[model samples]
Target: MEGLEIGLNGNLVDAETQQEGGRFFAADASSSNYILLQCKDVLTLEQKEELKRLHVTLLSYPAYNTYYCRYEPTELDEIRALPYINYANIYRPEFVTEAGLKDKLENSDEGHQPPEEKRYEVYISLHEDHRNRLEQIRQKIIQVLGIDPELVNADAFILRAKLQSHEIARVAGIDEVQRIEEIPRLALSNNHARVDLNLEYIIGAANSRLVVGGGLGQIIAIADTGVDDQHEALRGRVRVIEGSRNTDARGHGTHVAASAIGSGNSLEFGPIQGTAPFATVLSHVIVDNAGNITWSPLMFQRAYNREYGARIHSNSYNVSHAGIFQQRQYDGLAQDCDRMAICLPQLVILFSAGNSAPFKNVTSDGEIESQAAAKNVITVGACESTRPMTRNPLTYDYYVAVPIPGYLALNLAGNRDQMALFSSRGPTKNTNGGPDDRRIKPDVVAPGTVIYSAKSSQLDLTLPNILPGAIEAGVPNDGRWSYMNGTSMSTPLVAGCCATIRGRIALQCHNLARIPSVLVKAILINGTKWMVGTNQDSQGFGRVNLAKSMVCFSNHLGCGFWPKQESDFARMQMIQGQELKIRVPLPTANPYPDGITPRFSLTVTMCYLDYPDQSGLVDHLSLKVLQKTRLPDGTFPERYGNKLPGEPADNRNNVQKVIWDGISAPAPFQHPDPFRIYVRVERLARDAQFLHHFALAWHVEEMSRGDAQFDFWNERMPSTDARNRFMRKD
Candidate 1:
C-alpha cells in the first residue's frame, strides 16, 4: 500500500478491483467480506496513507514476521489472552550470539564492588547425591550466594541463581558445591528451510500408506521462535508452550513446525503435508521479539517433560556459529539433556548442520557449527536433488537428461544429489581432549532445495501475493503454502524419519520396543546411499534412505533386531578406563531357493551423550569389534579372555562401524562364530564426569543375497525377526 498508485486508465473507479488501483485484495477463504492486499514491495508514503484510509493493518513483509499491529496502536498495554497475559514476551532476540552477551556479563563482573541489592543470573552444579542432598545444597547455596535460587533439575541437582556465575566458584568452599559455570546467552536457533526431504519417494511416507513412516506414534518438540497454532495446516495438532500464546510472530518457528510434521489436511493446503503428518509437534518459542535464542535451558526441560516427553527434538536453532571452540556452558547443557535421553532411549535431538556455506568458519576450517558438535545429537546438512542435462553450444542440439544423486558425475550447484553449497561442512573442531582430535561431522545430508510447505495465514494477511494481479508479478505465494530452503528444512526430514521408524518399533508392530540411539544412528548411516565425490566433511555417511532404514530396523535387509535370541539390548553406565563388552551371534550366509550364494556381516555401534571432559574436551569414547572364533577344543578362544593372533579387530570411533566382508580367496568370508563389541570409555582428565551412560546395538546381516526367513511379527507374540516385515510372501 505504501508505494501503490491509484489510477484506472482515466475510468476513475474505486480501488476495489483490477490493476488500476485495487490490484491486491484477496478475500479470506471463509468469508468474502474480508480481503487481503499484500504489497509486493515496501510501502511508500502515499501507499501508507491509502492503507490507513482503507483501515487496513500491516502484518508481514519479505522478512516473514507476522505482526497484526502494535500493542499501543490497539491501545493495549498487555495481551489479555490466558497464556500470553504479558505482551513484552512477544519481542524477538535482543542478542543472538554468545560473544555479545559475554562482554556484557564480563563487564558486569569487572571493577565493581558488589552491591547486596543487585541480582544476577548464575548456574551451579552440585556434587552430592541429589536424592539426599538436594535440600541441603539449596539452603547452603542460598546462604553462600546470598540470593534466591531456581531449582533446575533434581537428578543432576542443577540450579540457576540470582548471584553472578563467577561468584559461585568463589563460594564452592562452602560445602555441597561441585562446579559453577556461567550460563550462556540463550537464543532461538535460526533455521529459516527442503520439500523432497519431506516427500514420500525419498522417505517412504506415502509408500507405507502413511501407516508407519507418517509419524503415527511419535512426538517432536520444535524449540524455536513461535508457532501459529491457528494456521489451517496445523490447527488441531499444535499445542503451544504453556505460557506463550498460540501464535507465530516471527513466522520462522511456524514454518519449521509445519514442515517437520504438519498434517496438511486443512482445506487450504491439503495437497502438501509434512514428513510426519501423524506426529505431534510441541512448540517452545525460545526466541523473543528481539530475534534471539537466548532463553534458559529450563524452558526446554519443561517442554521435554510435557505429555510423557517428546521422542525427538527438532532444533533449527543454535547457540553460536560453529567456530566456537566447544562452548563450555552450552555444550555441558546439551550433554546433560542427552544423559536424560539415554535414560529414555527414544529421546534424541536433531540439529541443523548450519548454513555457513562454502566458506569455513574462522574457529574451524570445517563446516561444523556450534550446537551441531554435540556427540549424542544427529547433525544434518543440506543436499539438493538435481538432474543433469547436456546441450551443444554452437550447434542445434537436443538436451539429454542424466539421473541424479548417482548420475551426476561432478559436484555442481543447481544440480541434484549434490551437497548444497550453503550447508555447513565438517571435520569438527577438536571435540576430543587433544587439539589433534577431530571427528567426522554432519552425520547425514538430505534434500534442502526450494521446499514448499504450509505458510502462515496470520502472516500473509497484508501481502496477498497469491490473489489477483499479484500472481502476474511472480510472487512465491500459494495461498496457505510457502517455499523455503536450508539445513533447517533437511533436519526435520531426519527427525520425521526417526518418528516413522519409532512408530513401527514402539507401536506393537515390531518385536522390539526400542533401539539405542547409537544403533539407530549407525543403521541410518549404514543404509544411506553415498553421494558422488563426497567426503566426511561435505556428506558424513551419505543421504538417508527411509525405506532402507525401516528395513534395517525391522531385522530385514540383513539386520538383527535387538532382544531376539541372537540380538540383545543393554543400557550401561561405565566409569573412566572401564570396558563393557556385549556379544551377539554372527550368522553365516547360506543359499536359498533362488540358488544364489549369499554373504554375511555383523555391525556393532555404540552411542552415548558425551559431556565436556573435566578438561573441557569433547570426544573421549570408543567402540571396538573383536572376532571370537571356536577353537579345536570347541571353546571360543576370546571367550576366556585369551587373545588370539590373526584376530580381526577394529577400535574406531564412538560411533564404531565394523563389517566382515566376503569373496576374498584367502578366507572367502570372515564371519566369526560370535562377534564381541568392546566399548572403552576413557577419561583423560580426572575431573571428568566419571559415569558414562551408553546404549549398544548389535546386528548380524547378510552381505549378499541370502535365503528368506519367516515374518517376525506375530500379532499373538512379538519377535525381533524380519520375516513378518520384509520378505517375498510364500
Candidate 2:
C-alpha cells in the first residue's frame, strides 16, 4: 500500500465501512489528493456509506453517475478497482492548498470545520410514473433527508419541502425525480360592471330568473386567502372546506369569492351581484394569515374537484419572482396546474394573468405569471372597468403615471374597452426551452380596474396596501364592500361566467352536467367581441361578453356543438393522420336588414383539453373552415382559426377560432348552395395512440348594427334530421 489510513475510532479502514460527512484521510495526505469518481450506475445508500470508510469524502454527485470526492492517495486504487467504477481522476483546486483550508477552518467559530449549509424552500415534481406513489416517495425523501414533517406540504402530485442546497442533488438522484426548480414566490394577481358584459341582455334573452340561467346546479371553487362566509353578500352561498380556514384575515379571498358568486343580498349591498350569483362557491383557503399562499394549486384542484365536486375552479394567485418581467418558462407550478386540468377534463380552471405591467419595459410582451402560464387553464387579463375614473382618481392617476415607458398613459383606464395598464400580457414564455415556440395567453380580458365587490369584515382596514394608495382607492371606511383592481378580480368574474356557460349548456343540452371543459371554453371564446383598444396579444380574443356567448346556445343561431345527441350534436374523437368535419347549416330565414336579401356572418371555435406530456410537447389540433358556396367574386372562401383570411391552420393553441365578418353568400336557389360551412379538426402529432376528443362550436347570424338582442321565442331549434353531418374516421 502507498499509504494507510485509520478511522476516527482508530480501526484499520476497509472499503466497506460506512461513515458520515467528510472522511478521514491518511495523516500525511493533503487536499490535493482529491479525485473524481465516475460510476456506471447511481450509488446505492449502502455503497455511499461504504465509501466513507475508505478515507474518502463523497463531496457531491453533481451529475448522473458521477461523484466529486476527496480521498487518500492509498485508497485511490481501491476506489478505482471497484467493479462499478468507470474512472477516477485527480480534482485540481485553482489556488487552494492544505494550509489555506486549515487557516480557514481554524478561524471558524466552531473550530476546524465548515459552516452549516443553508436551506431552501423548494417545490419538487416527481416523475409521472411515480405520481401515484406520491405519498410513499415523499416518505422516502423524508427518511433520506431527515426532514421535518412540518416543512412538508400535503399536496396531491407535486411535493414541496425545505432542504439544504447540497441535499437537492441527493433528492434528484432519487429515481422518482423528474425536474427540480427553485420554488418561485407566488402572489395574488381581478372585475367590472354587469352592463359591460351585457348580462342584462343575456338574462332577459334567456328569460331565466338569474344571469346565464342562474348557473343552476353548478359549483365554483375559489382558492385564495380566506372567505368570510358570514358576510351578507356571500353568507348562505359560501361553503368553506375542511382543513381550510373560513375566516378572512387578509381579506383577499373574500373579495374573490364575492366577485364570482356573491348573491348581492339587495337588503345589504344593493344590486352589486356577482356574475353567477346563484352558483354555489366552495371556498378553499390556500393563503395564510400573512397573505402567503400556503398550498400549491394542484392541492386545491384535487380537493375541490374530487372532494367537493366543484368543476369550476378560480385562482387569483400565481408564482412571482423578482426581476422576472415575464414567465417565459412553463415551470413546475404551471405544470402542476396543467396536470390537474388534464386529469379532470370536466374542471374549468382559471388563473389571473399577473399584475406586473408596471415593472415591464415597453418591449416586454410575455408578462404572464407562472401558474397563469399553464396551457390548460384559462388565463384572464384586466381591462378598464366601466366604473367612472372619477370614483377612483388616485388609481386613475397612478395608471397614467406608471413607469412602463410606452405602455402606460393618461385615460387608459377611463375607457371600458381599453386594456388596464397593470394587467399582465403574454406569449406564455416559450415551451420546451425554445425561443420561437411561445404560446398566446390571457385567453380573454374582463373589467379589472376599480372593480367593486364584497369585503371581509374581519380584515383590518388600517393595513397598508400593496399598490400605492390602494387602500384609499379600494377599501372604504365601512369595510362592507371593496373597490379593488387586479387580474384577480377579472379571474373570478370569468369563473362565474364559466359557471354560467356550464349551467346554460346543461339546460340546453339535456342536462349535460359534465360538459367537457373545452366546450365551455369554446362557447366563451366564440362569443368574445374583439377589443379595439388593445393588441391581440394583450387582450387575447377579446373581452368576454356573456350575452354573445349565451346567444351561441340560442336555438335560433345556426350553431351546433356536442353532447346533444337528440339534435345529433356530438363531439369528435380522432388519432394521428385523421380529420373530423362538421357541417353547420346557415339560417335561410330572411331576418336581416332586407326582407328578401341574405347577409350573415359566421364564427367557429374548436377547443380541446390536451393530454399532458412529460416532454412539454402537448397534443395539437388544427381548425379550418371552408364555405360550401362561392362568394360574389366567384371563389370559395376558406379560413383558419386564429389565422388571417387565408393563413395556415393554427398549431400553437388548444383553442382555435375563425370569424367570417361580412359574407353575402349566393342565393338559396344557387348551385352548390344550401349555404353551409364545413369545419374541420385535424390532429397533427402521432405521439400517442389514445383517441383525443375535441369540441366544435359555430355561430351564424345576420350582420346588423343593433343592441345585443336575440329573439329566442321565435327561434327554431335544429331538427333531429337537420342535415348537419359529422364525418370522422377511426
The C-alpha RMSD in Å for every predicted model, in order, reads 23.4, 12.8
Report the C-alpha lDDT of model 1 over 1-730, residue by residue, as the tens digit.
Answer: 2222221111111223422224332222122211223233334445444444544443211011111221212212212121311111111111111232335455664446554334445445543233257566677666665554553333353665555434533454443343444555543322112233323433222225423557775778887767888876688887776776666655666767877787655343345566677888888877656565554435545656745367677888654433433433223455455444544555667888876643322344575644676556788887874412121121101000224232233233544457766677775653321123345678888876455556665553342211111121113435665545567767887877777766755653355544455545655555455577766678876787655555445423234433322134333444456767665533243323244344544444455555332212332456665555556787643311111234443222345444443422112224523466676655322222334445554444444434422222212222223222433211
Instruction: Name the best candidate (by TM-score).
Output: 2
> Candidate 2: deviation at residue 290, Å?
1.3
Task: Put down candidate 2 lDDT per residue, 591-702, tens digits, no spaces.
Answer: 3233334345678887766644321334557777777666789987788888998678776777788887666644422332343433343432222232444577777654
What does candidate 1 score on TM? 0.61
Q: Total clashing residue pairs per candidate?
A: 40, 6
The 0-to-1 C-alpha lDDT of every candidate, in the order given, reads 0.49, 0.63
Candidate 2 structure lDDT: 0.63
| Model 2 pairs in collision | 190-486, 190-487, 190-488, 190-489, 190-490, 328-429
